[model samples]
Target: MSSLALHVADKRPEDPADLTGFYAGLLAVLNDAALNHHGWTGSVVADLGEIGGYVYMKIRPGEGDEPFATIEDLRAFRKRQAEEARRTEEASKQARLI
Candidate 1:
């Protein structure tokens, strides 16, 4: 199951640094939610937007149908994919040499 977490900033800042700070604070709140929320295992998809002079963030558990993937999991998957691609390329080169 997936859950959506929403956060709204009281005021939108004109300065980029203030916007960054707002996002940072929002992420902290979302991280806390991820820690406390049941069925939320830290993997999330989040989006930020502004409307009516307010900044809003929406976060949800990533891909509800599948098991969540952590940063380590994604890194390992990327490594494996790269390795497989390298092996395939090497095999192609050997075949060409034949």
Candidate 2:
């Protein structure tokens, strides 16, 4: 099966102990969304803050072809993210107004 991987990185050297738990939280969210059914494999790591470590999810396509997000999917995702950001900003503004 072809595989695709995602990476999350931070440049700060905070607490390494928090990395695994952070990634586990992410995994829980992803798994809750049935991401595993999408052929995703995930992992997390932390090394000296230089690497910043990351949580990686791999997607495998059928027939051993690499999995890729279509342009439509990318666009949809971007739109959703933007919407969420806007909602968050609006909420923050309302909270500040209170």
TM-score of 2: 0.36
The TM-scores of all predictions, comma-separated, are 0.49, 0.36
lDDT of 2: 0.43
Deviation of model 1 at 15, angstroms: 3.2
Query: Largest TM-score belongs to which candidate?
Result: 1
lDDT of each: 0.60, 0.43
- Reference-based lDDT, residue 14, model 1: 79
Instruction: Give the total clashing residue pairs for model 2.
Output: 0
TM-score of 1: 0.49
Off by more than 4 A, model 2? 1-4, 8-68
**Tens digit per residue, CA lDDT, model 1, 5-31:** 544455677787776566556666766
